[model samples]
Target: MEQSTAASRPWLLLLCLAVAATGGVLQARAQLDSKGFISVDCGLPGKASYVDGGTKLSYVSDAGFIDDTAGANQNISGQYIRPQLSRRYHDVRSFPDGTRNCYTLRSLVSGRKYLVRAAFLYGDYDGLGRLPVFDLHLGVNYWQTVNVSTPGFEVTAEAIVVVPDDFVQVCLVNTGAGTPFISALELRPLKMKFYPQVNLMQGLVLDVRLNLGPADLTDIVRYPEDPHDRVWIPWADPKEWMEISTTKQVDSEYDDFEVPTAVMQTAVTPLNASMKLEITWDPVPQPHDLSPGYFIIMHFSELQLLPSNALREFDININGVRLSEAIRLVYLGVGVIFNEKPYQDGNYNISIKATANSTLPPILNALELFSIMSMTNFGTDSRDVSAMTTIKTKYHVEKNWMGDPCAPKTMAWEKLMCSYDTGIPPRIRSVNLSSSGLNGDISPSFADLKALQHLDLSNNNLTGTILDTLSQLPLLKILDLSGNQLSGSIPSGILKRIQDGSLNLRYDNNSNLCTNANSCRPAKMKSKLPIYVGAPIVIIVVIVSVALTLFCLLRRKTPGLMKNSVKPQNETRNDGDTSLGLETRRFTYNEIERITNNLQQVLGKGGFGYVYDGFLEDGTQVAVKIRSESSNQGDKEFLAEVQILTRIHHKNLVSLIGFCKDGVHMALVYEFMSEGTLQDHIEETEMQDA
Candidate 1:
């Protein structure tokens, strides 16, 4: 989840090595290395630049993050910086990317004697690139930053850090925290020599007791009767509290400390919303470990024990083009998602350039996004992403499933996917009508869709048998009939027929589906011997008997035995024969069917129908083309191939050997050629010459 290059890998690895070598608990201290380091001083025009106010940032991924405002006026004291990532802005000042946001900090001073510390409010748990931050409770990993200040200061006990004069990208990361919040940040001159050097500790310990509304919060409270009435103090005794720097402390008397709290709740008020846990600690006067620690005994309310998970969707957007269903987002700590889409609409430079004052390396994180027409929730159910895409492409439904559809382009209504069918007029490919409380049977007109692939009618008040007409589709892939009041036998016939025809059937939770023994009741029959045995035998017998009878009749009616017999094998035959013609075909349905073997091993399906991979007796590979009854152009293509191949003779054109003319079953059989079609060659070029 978190990636660090050898050069850009966090100093944590070096810190780990240091701890290992030290044996004892290595004290958090500041080290000064005069080695080559690039440092830029802010406010010197060319040296330090500012991201002017009103500059736009576009988040092009599910971890949507963007720069919403111009850089805060050089805040030397770190107070009241406008919210960039989490704070909502109207029109001109919207948060560009989703949470997991990042902002650039510039280095102001580029010299010794002055240690610069910078901090910002991090949301969605990671720093600029969605990287994790340190924990505030249970110890020392709460704040992360580099420090060149001298040792002897217990400054590493806070949630902020100080570093040298280098351009760095600081990301707020907390693997344990579900969401992130920051109230204030500070940057000041560090008096490193004044603090006493101590061994590095991973946790921060506070010792102050808070006056509660007649309750004890010394231990972890599970289901507390009144969480609102119960106030908590991290330290046990109030006397243990000392006057430390204001920037480092997390929580103090609200009257005293300038910290952000959840929308406040009165004492004894019903806890309707999930309470946000807030932890604040001292600041790091120097660089220290800022990994997430653990939570000690804390106070919480009892109304009920509620464990819930949040959902997050991740997408990728390369360059300016948006891909569809590209990224998978997962939560490391809560095991759920926090932010959804990362990219927002606008122009971006497509680079990771920092714009603030700090001493951290530039992070190489970019955004990617996928385009979805529409998405909807039917019930308390999670649908497969693939299944959802199929349904949308099937019903000719329309929606901008990914919220906003076009960027800097004309817009359509929400929940619509339109494809350019001809010269730009849109053809709807998907529709999501789940849980809209609609009542009716699915319109039979849906089967008219030749390009439809996905259809979802779950959790609705629809009633009807699975349409037999649907089986005629050559592209239909996913069908959801769950949570409906439809009564009928499972459409096992249709299922078995289309199992290999891009059809995925989902009919569970529909109680009316019958699996008993009866033709009227659709039996859930798996595709195997039984259905194959019955259907193929009848067709095979009829085709073979008809072929033999026709052959016998033709032989008797011919003028001579030699004339009725097969032609002598000749490699030196002329292109044109008076009776047979130059290009001719004489093949039986039985032969074509036998060669295709019940239409197995399909190469691909197009607007016509399935194309099967086959080989002649001579061991040359070929394509067996079949026309689907549902294809509007099926007959047209068959006739076109016959007419064109008869005249066209080139190395590129297929050499037609024969064709079949079964009733309503038109096919073309050509000399076996290993080379595939031009389209196939372009799509997969690595294959053997075709």
Candidate 2:
């Protein structure tokens, strides 16, 4: 046995204890008692020694070899590493005279916290004769568990967690020059049982899979705990620690693994209340391992933790939209195999939220999700499509021409055009409809299409004065009106109003307009009444002027004009028994076509129809809508959209732009919202994608 040095080893032991504390809380009783220490001797030629518990002495052969002249700095006997006795050592080992020689070492230290005794020897080699030249190196032979903190040992243990101390060797390259090599090189700190209370339970699984057979255990990864020496189960295994079956791949899409089996057991168990559980799996088929890669899967089940609220739904703010939905739990699966070690090494994490139904109460029980093994080449298309479709179906709002609004691709609708350059969600652009035989007033609900840009409503049998509601549009630019029987003069001054603020407006056509001096302005003038007297005429004129000024001011400030101006669209369906027998109101296609001027009345087009700004014989301004046969829309989707639109009475939702049922020329009429769709504002970088 080598003599032990009694200095500088205790300081190193204390440093390693501080590192362990960062991992987590350690058992207070797991530390070593005082009077334990590790030391090396300078008097020995090639022996290294350690003392634990202050009495027991452990030593290793060829542990403290030193060489210095092997390199340009000095001689072969110049290198030596040994613990200091009161921080001093005089040990000497020498080489033959004038011969450059190299020295190597293999030593053992406490697995817990061993200190390294390092030194260099170079002066007066060869028994105080000629100087020798040799190379020196340091290497670890292999791994072996050692206990230095055992009770009744020789060394004096300190208050630190472990005794003796971990040790590492520093090498000086080309010490003597002649091609020196040290075999069995290893440089890792010894580990002891670090986490005693953390036990591997049933929920931690290894999903081994076979091609067409049952679960295979041969490929599963395993971790073993030693009973004698205090072992430290690593926080996680290295990337390439496990292997999976060659035949079957694993995945978590189905929320389960093909086969789950426990490969290792832990001595520590989770807490009874508020337990925070974690599971990690090491991967097989590492780059150093053989081909035909394998994978590891770990599943964790949180036993009985309760949420803060018993209510099913959680209100969350997503991309500026306030969404209230149930807090759902989703299964997570992590895969690692061979080159896929980083994933298994715990570098990246995955998060998934489960689905919650508003109508049902949440289940108060353990949450279980499986970790499965899947081939690296597996695709995500199937999962993504199904998931998105499920969300759309649950929402239940059908998109006109677009099928489900969340579809991967946009479908062509009547007057709708989609942006070709954008990704995923394409933008809606231009909508045009010059004329097609149609009837009905505009539905204000059309404004919900925030992506709309250009809207045209030229000609149709729509009746009613153009409502000021349209002035609220922020993006409207163009407006067209050429034909239609509208009679009231356009209120040009009132055209610029908005629901909450001012917006642009477009107006034309409707030849009966008398508000402005145009060719179509009425020539009729009220017959001059011979005022009873000049005095009375002057008085009447003054009173009229004052009243007109006051009215104009009041109109400008009317707070709820948009909300109050909206009228409910009246339509009736034919049902069997009418308590008071009444005739059904219907019209033929030809009659409607004549009203639209041989399908000449044309306005703007959108996802639904070609709008025609028109008027009834009574001179009511209205918008006639005609649905396009070319639209990819179906009846079910159309009706669903219509149902929602008609029921929504908000000032922001466009009203039923109106409709017609002339044979295949079916259309709806609406109160013309002079302001176009929101699409206009989105153009030229006016808005951002929220």
Candidate 3:
């Protein structure tokens, strides 16, 4: 039956968005530094910036995203989740159906261009072992379908857009396939000239971003090193390709068409600079309504410290058309060019051959392709911004509330009313903080909003005064303050207004709140029949009896744990739990090495294996235990330890994060136990005895 179910499962159809990864193509020197850069380690919260030994560059946690909702902040746990990553990528925010999940970005310069990058890695973070497919959006526009086709691998989509107002909204919509989620996201400021032709059409949809000519295949280049923080994936010299590099410096004048110095430093030139690269790819099938043309870009810089007389000139050939001739790349200078062209029929790849050269062989530092689209700018309302800002602080809301409150009307912040207009920014008109677990006095500042007409602070723990200063609002009509701890007699002016039918009041369920004599009386209870009363008692007796019986059965089977005993020192586990939860991730042996930096950062040596302190991609601290090859502990002991750790959870107990069991190589991963061990604490308590 299980095999049948597995066989019936639908194989995921990859909805890979064909976006070409192209940085500022129009090239300018205007850049946003770390302070201006917005990095959102979505679904996770941590503040860390470090120089990654692998990338040889500094990467910081995404800085500006608010978790204003009550959604779960989850970390994905799966066999395929990659290792040696900052912990941030492991975090995700899941969205339920019927409501769209959105994140707003603020602290941005208006009318400035930005590179929006959204990353997703669904390593079954919920531990369901099932990958989900969903859609990712930019403002109210559809961006791409987020399909976790291969486990542990990352899928990313990017777009370049101008900041319409003071903010922008990145949202996730549930297409009814599964709960949508996001792992990490970032925004880089670009000059208006980044995509000069972008104004001629819609925004550019990213397809591929590739870095060429690296000795290492696993090499990845990212931030601090590349001030723009463009992620450059390295492509090493393949067997079919010949690689050459000169110890000469290379530079480019077009700062907006910037190519990373790291990539430009190395060049991929054919054995014969005259021979063209016959690159051919299949046509990317497009929907009937979408255009299939792509904008191709190649980056070049003068390589090889040479005399001024040496010149590298080549013509670019795409398909059968010769796009450029007499193109020269001067030493220590840069040149970047791109053109929009449709893919050749029956071929998905475009061939770029270097022919008709002037001096040197053809070489490329980097290349990218993007689908062009019209530019769009949409943001939130300026009015009523302060009221919500004050409300967020007063309630200790999550930082996920970064974008506009209602501009893109379809993706408004939860429980808020707005006056949305197509070309005009929306204005805050109402707020509903119902059943939100809010605790405090409803701020009088909220009463000052001139546009606010309806305010619902329902089912909260508000205290102090009733009908305090809220009556001053001129447009106020609807108010719901029920199910709270509000006290004091209703103000005479408010009561008269409520009685005169000038306002719609919902002030029920507040125990101490008094409006009239009948309203002051305690809530009446419904009486139960004798059979109902007796049934509950009988049910309770049966539940307690069954619980006690199970307790005895467990105690009998796990006698060693019930009564403490001095067991063998070599033993890894004691009898405790019959089963376990093991909510953390399980890693493979290969992943363990990456997470532990090949197990080089050792904290201490144990009887079973060495303990190494490690951090996730987002810089979260953890400890990994790699079983020793010669250890006497066997499979049974390892399983017992894992089971015991999973069964027990407490503040004082060390958490078993995950484990690895590959053939004979077994290991355990755990949360780092700080403040030393319990034994150390006891020993310090009896310092004189030592």
**Per-prediction TM-score, please?**
0.20, 0.21, 0.55
Cα RMSDs, all models: 26.9, 33.3, 30.3
Q: Write the per-residue lDDT of candidate 1 for residues 55-123, one digit (tens) a residue.
A: 111111111121223112221112222344212111011122232223223443432222222223322
The candidate that achieves the highest TM-score relative to the unseen native structure: 3
- Once model 2 is optimally superposed onto the true structure by TM-score, how far is the C-alpha of residue 654 displaced, in angstroms? 40
Q: Write the per-residue lDDT of candidate 3 for residues 1-690, one digit (tens) a residue.
A: 123333212211111222212321323334336566666666655665555455333444443354545356678775554567655576787776335666777778867778889888887778776677877667756666677887577889898776555776787777677778777777888767666646422667677777778767577766755667777888755654666554433444444566666677776866665665555555454432244556677776655544555556665555545554446555556667666333324543444555453455667777777765434434454546656767777887543453456645655777777876666656677888888888988787687576778988899899866754676666778788888888765565555444344555566567665433223433222111101111223454565466457656766797654233222323333232223323545666665765655564465667887776554443344678778887888876776565555555544455777777666668777765334543444445588577
**Quality of model 2 by C-alpha lDDT:** 0.31
User: What would the per-residue lDDT of candidate 2 be over residues 10-67, giving only the tens digit for each residue?
Assistant: 1111001111212233232222322222234333433444442322333222343333
The alpha-carbon root-mean-square deviation between model 3 and the true structure, to one decimal in Å, is 30.3
Clash count, one per candidate: 88, 110, 52
TM-score of 1: 0.20
Candidate 1, residue 240: Cα displacement in angstroms equals 3.7
